[model samples]
Target: MATTSESEPTTVETPGSDDQSREGEIFDLLSNQRRRYAIHYCKREDDPVTLGELAEHVAAWELDKEVAAITSAERKRVYTSLQQTHLPTLERADMIEFDDRTIELTDEAAELDVYLDVVPADSIPWGTYYLGLAAVGSVVMAGLWLEIVPTEAVPELGWATLVFALFAVSAVVHVVQNRRMRLGEMERPP
Candidate 1:
């Protein structure tokens, strides 16, 4: 009979064991701008998109030009990169179904939206905004507790209600904005 000591480590496989690794893989796949653009394009389409069309749109976005304005050279560079590198990576990850000419998103591709929260360069992140709001609320509560003249003008219950209202409104707006920021949620990629 084989015996194991208490000091020995054992491994147990759980149904959700792969979730963390899968999330990491998803993040890695989305880290590239071209891959994200390709995924966004496929996501917006109800059917598969041709490789040429995907490459043209991606190149145009990268160049900040219209698809019609994209130079053949620019399109070709993006086409080659997607064909040789990005597409295969995404396909292997099961995020997209890619053939020689066309690409379509798989069910797994939709899962990526949960991880995509697009924040513009000039905008603050939702987490930061919430943190700031919480800080302000705390300061206000402190003032009320200390019976500061302005804060004391309102009853404690009224102040509490006001604070709750602010957070409630902020949360609702956050949810709406977050949904809009998700990949493929808007006319353009978030």
Candidate 2:
């Protein structure tokens, strides 16, 4: 039997090693709501923003208040929080390059957008939406089967075929949209 030297290291190939590492890092960086908000604000910018401006916007968003309505106290609170805590955390992750004066996003940080979802407050979750669709589809199919609805207007097999096609097409569209967002090529729809 041959024994390997203790000083020698072996390389192991883990499945999706790089992607998994990146995904974990993204989750880490975005763990905090404040950090997510910072990324959301930064991702839409055309240029580097002053820390003050960034703080103001972030504060407004956090408070769910208008920028014009933001009080001096609110501004100061957010500014201090970012300056002392959040900005340093993001800087260490290479998500953003933050100076005492101005802040800018890094290219690596752009990849973070893929992991963040921007769902509207009023909308239902996709899982719930799909469940509702399935329920309605089942009821419609049952109606067709029992002749609760007119067969002359639409046959049972024909109705089921159309419903399945609609779902298949909708699923395809949903997948394409998800891929686009996951690639960081598109922002979440408002």
Candidate 3:
């Protein structure tokens, strides 16, 4: 009996794997609204901010009011939550560096903006809205094709142009949204 040695490629973890793991961690840490608010506040600031300032912004956001309207009690409540819970969790996830007095975002924290989407209540989801637009555009096109709608004033090509314009505008908006969602990357204007 001959014993044969079989060779198999050993799997090595890529650098991207580390990034993916950190991204997952970031998503988990940012799952809480307070944590998300903390990240947004940190990104907006040019310098490291005190916990008090962060809490004020968070409290204001939570209460759906202006920062000037944030009461001391409200601020303190958010401050305590941040100090004990959110900040530490973020720090653990390597999203931010925190100490007793001040906290600052790390490079990893910059990657989190992509996951934070703020949709207004009155607005429909983008997918649904786009579908509705396409439906309307299709009906208009069909009307023009079948000569059911009056096109004597406006040329058939004009109706098609309107549909095309609508789609083009929507595409531009979607591109802008995608650019905003880019994490840790800067978009430079030519």
Candidate 4:
């Protein structure tokens, strides 16, 4: 019979590169997607919620409540009561003097924050960049029509007519550009 060493599990700790004293393992209490959802719900939350309310929210999202009900969730729910709810309260007291760079977060929220950023700011409309370019193109076409191209010299055509002509040409170019963009083609036409 092989005897197992019962000292304890070796926890992974981060390097103490900074002055803050959070050198030990950062608790990934909110790492679980369900727990994260609950925490996010709490972040938006006006006040601290009871465990029962959080459990209800997590349970509601369960497509297979029968499966998650037995092990991961039921046990996890109690664990979450400690991990997601109580531990956070405890960790609130475990604060290192905020030196600005030192982070105090679970392994999950820290990882997530890398991607999602910590700020609760609203999202930018990326489409606005395209719309803005289109507006600039219109303005440039107008300038070319009014200033660069002399219409009367081309016979009967006025500046307005020149603007319309340039706009027509630009429309073709715009459509082609849009088509290429939709197809994810970046090569310029030769």
lDDT of each: 0.87, 0.76, 0.77, 0.43
lDDT tens digits, residues 42-101, model 2?
A: 766647888888788888878888889999999999899999999999898888899898
Off by over 4 Å in 2: 1-4, 7-13, 135-150, 156-190
- Range of the 10 consecutive residues with the lowest summed lDDT in candidate 3: 181-190
Clashes of each: 0, 0, 0, 0
After superposition, candidate 4 runs with Cα above 4 Å error: 1-32, 62-190
TM-scores, all models, native as reference: 0.86, 0.67, 0.69, 0.29
TM-score, structure 4 vs. true: 0.29
Q: For candidate 1, lDDT tens digit of each residue in 16-70?
A: 7799889889899999999999998887776899999999989988888889999
- Model 3 regions more than 4 Å off: 1-24, 64-73, 144-151, 171-190
> What are the runs in model 1 whose C-alpha is more than 4 Å off?
1-17, 149-152
Ranking according to lDDT, highest score first = 1, 3, 2, 4
lDDT of 1 at 117: 77
Candidate ranking under TM-score, highest first, comes to 1, 3, 2, 4
Query: What residue pairs clash in candidate 3, if any at all?
Result: none
Residue 41, candidate 3: alpha-carbon lDDT: 75
C-alpha lDDT of residue 65 in model 1: 87
